[model samples]
Target: MLIELRPGTSAEAAEEVAARAGAHEDVTAWPVRLAGRVFVVVSGDESLAHVPASPAVLARRPTPDGHWLVRRDSGVAPREVTIGPPLSGPPEAPRQVGVVGGPRLWWAAGPCALESTEDAVETALTVRAQGAHALRAGLSKTRSSPYHFPGRGLRGLEALAEIRRAAAIPVITEVCDPREVAAVAEVADCLQVDGRQLDNRPLLAELGAQRRPVLLMRGPRASLDDWLRAAEFVFTRGNSAVVLCAGATGTPQQPGFGAITALRARTELPVIFDPSHSTRSASLVAPAALAASAYGADGLLIESCTKPERLYRPGDAAHMFPPESLADLVATCERVRDSARSLEVSC
Candidate 1:
């Protein structure tokens, strides 16, 4: 639950009310502002309970647009304040250990094999054309098969460095352990904590120590409460630049899961959805992307390959959409966001 303060409300008065509101059952309180209106966003069972239940401001209402705006009369006139559906903004400045590039539409790419510098450059070009703000790939893979090609490790990190150098886009890679965290930190712009490693508290702490933006994936089996606490492990270290990645649960849900819904409701960190790994069917990518956007996700971290058939990964081939398909999905996501914002005006 998010709260916004109205115009003319004193911060001190608002803070006092918020403190009282926070003490209500199951409520988590935070303050937000838009166009000079102060808001108190509440979560848990205590959200609407603390709002003035009087005849003037007690009722919940919606604007002509689809957004839910809190309507209350401040004695003189009725007032409405804006509260954003979840969104992500770039930090004021790149932290000492994070990506140099700014905030953007991120696309996680999977290049299963190590390729030449030229190949990486070409791939990065195609990715940029698709409007991806940043590119994600695997430098050190944690695969099920020990004899498999795995990842290029340092060599792949070098390739990613070259890709960033050539394309001038931020590059993200996976780090499996503390040593790899340091090693990957040396080359890539961000370090990812894979969903499988969700329980590895040690790695979470180590990544926090690096002070880079950590993309923590939600384990297919873990609860949302568990996921956020894991995120807090990093934040408690004073590293606030953390992001969440929602993938499919390993069960029949394959690509989408309750975890997606649960995490979106609970955490304020930016979350990116992984369609390729979560929904194994290519046909599901468009709808999944649409659903995630509608639910206020920070962004989509999809895998867009120029040619899915020619790729060297184990994910669903259909999910590895062509550039055109990916473009369509992105457009749809924009439409959903527009529709959500449209809800604001109708009120």
Candidate 2:
């Protein structure tokens, strides 16, 4: 059974209830600190009847599957727009692409930017061989510095199309301008809206009209409410295939997992974590990736390259994961996800 403590309930009050529940011989109380709730697994038939209840307990519900289904009122007013069906892939592979509604993890891997046709193709092949489900690259890169490489425009999209055809995998690419949406939608399997462009309504409207799945990156400085409102712009435009990509914010020492947790709790959209940008460190990617999976991310969008040292892009040294390292990270992430699933079931 899952129980939600009332809002503003003191920690001491919650702990008192937890202790009382834990004292029951057949009940094992597990406090979910993230959401400030408690899950009491009832093992004995008589204990269920003995459990205490009070006004402080907002909700108590049984979950036969051992998974808690939590729904809280976010207090954000609903937009005056139609919400389409839950976004999903084809009928056969229903949850492959859209926000995954299952335990299976989706993997997206490729170079941060499309270096060239040859480089993109080679990297795509390597990613596919190493168990990635999709390919991601920037067709028109967004950089903070004016001198940085600004991706291969139309040529990159052409290369991604060719790689998609050859590799038999879905291709995902970033689109920074409204003018480029139509062209990017033509070749890319999913269009990614960069974090910097979250408030660009014209571009969001253009993407919504394309009817293709979109990966909306959460702005580093934007609040959770702000991010979801941006998604609302896309959702209200008749396109429901929206995935939330949680980008890191704050200093390197304090990456934003709070926003990730809040987004997962507040919205039904599939959430994907970009550990490459989250930690901004190749060395920290593995640990962060594992943490994301354990924290219930539906998928991961990673930046990797065939040759990190040979790359000329800024942050290449800090963020690029080599093929071997990526492979290891993927394997470990899979294990962590499997373990998490097991724990969920055993609860």
Candidate 3:
């Protein structure tokens, strides 16, 4: 059970409430000042109503899965409570990679959209040789224009599956509709939800229910709080295998790398930056990717192709780099990652 003390409740009063409620001293009176409340963890069997009702008591709620939602008393309508366990305290090992406790940088690189099995496999092979750990391509894209190469649909998915098996690399694809969730999950090692579908409850719910690792891209205009809430939707549905992909939105005004910093300060989720989409220029991808690495990104999602001049639909003309250039970019990013790791060790 978790009890939320009223506003302005002194530390002594909080301690007295915890003592009366028989809460374990070691685990009581956890102060969450950001939410403007102090939470006291008591025994499951303890009833908070038995405590004397006073001005100090604001609300009592059961902690569900070690999380609580306490209401604030400021507006006519209660605003959505954003309180939860501290997720930004320190850098922790991510569950997706199953590593112990060191800085691990994941490199995912491939074409922006799947054109054919041959193209995906060739690109995957090139990226793998360049030290990329995973292959990413959009089987189904959410484009601004309906006629602008909406993707090859099921055939593209089949091609991506073949690329995974033939190239011996993990594949990631975007899922635009709820109906395609299961099908995409069956073939993709990880499912991606584009920024356009951030508010798509049905699609988000389906992804959550599928329980597959998800790459959640922040919407172009979405605030930091909105992104966190979007993640919360998936978290509450029991899908904790989420990787935050920043700067993959469709909007022209890039949120910049600073958004990544803000995100890291708010959550402990693994973050991957999409520099190709952010800058929308092939020449700028390397600098943006290196900046992302310097800013403590867990990984990068780069768009690389065998031939950048001849790109498929939904592919940004200025964003795709050739395989040779991709190899060079990967080497540079590796150096940055190594330097960042050394800095972390020294600190």
Predicted structure with the largest lDDT when compared to the true one = 2
- Model 2 global lDDT (CA atoms, 0 to 1): 0.67
Give the clashing pairs for model 2: none
Tens-digit lDDT track of model 1 for 116-141: 55655676667666666556666766
Q: For model 3, what is the alpha-carbon lDDT of residue 222?
A: 74
Error of 3 at 59 (Å): 11
Candidate 2 residues lying further than 4 Å off, grouped into runs, are 1-99, 251-253, 341-347
Rank the candidate models, highest TM-score first.
2, 3, 1
lDDT of 1: 0.57
- Candidate 2 lDDT, tens digit per residue, 199-262? 8989987886776778888778866766776775664344656777886875443456566567
What lDDT does candidate 2 reach at residue 92? 25
* Regions of candidate 1 where Cα sits further than 4 Å from its true position: 1-117, 257-261, 314-318, 341-347
CA lDDT scores, all candidates in order:
0.57, 0.67, 0.66
- Report the C-alpha displacement of residue 181, candidate 3, in angstroms: 0.5
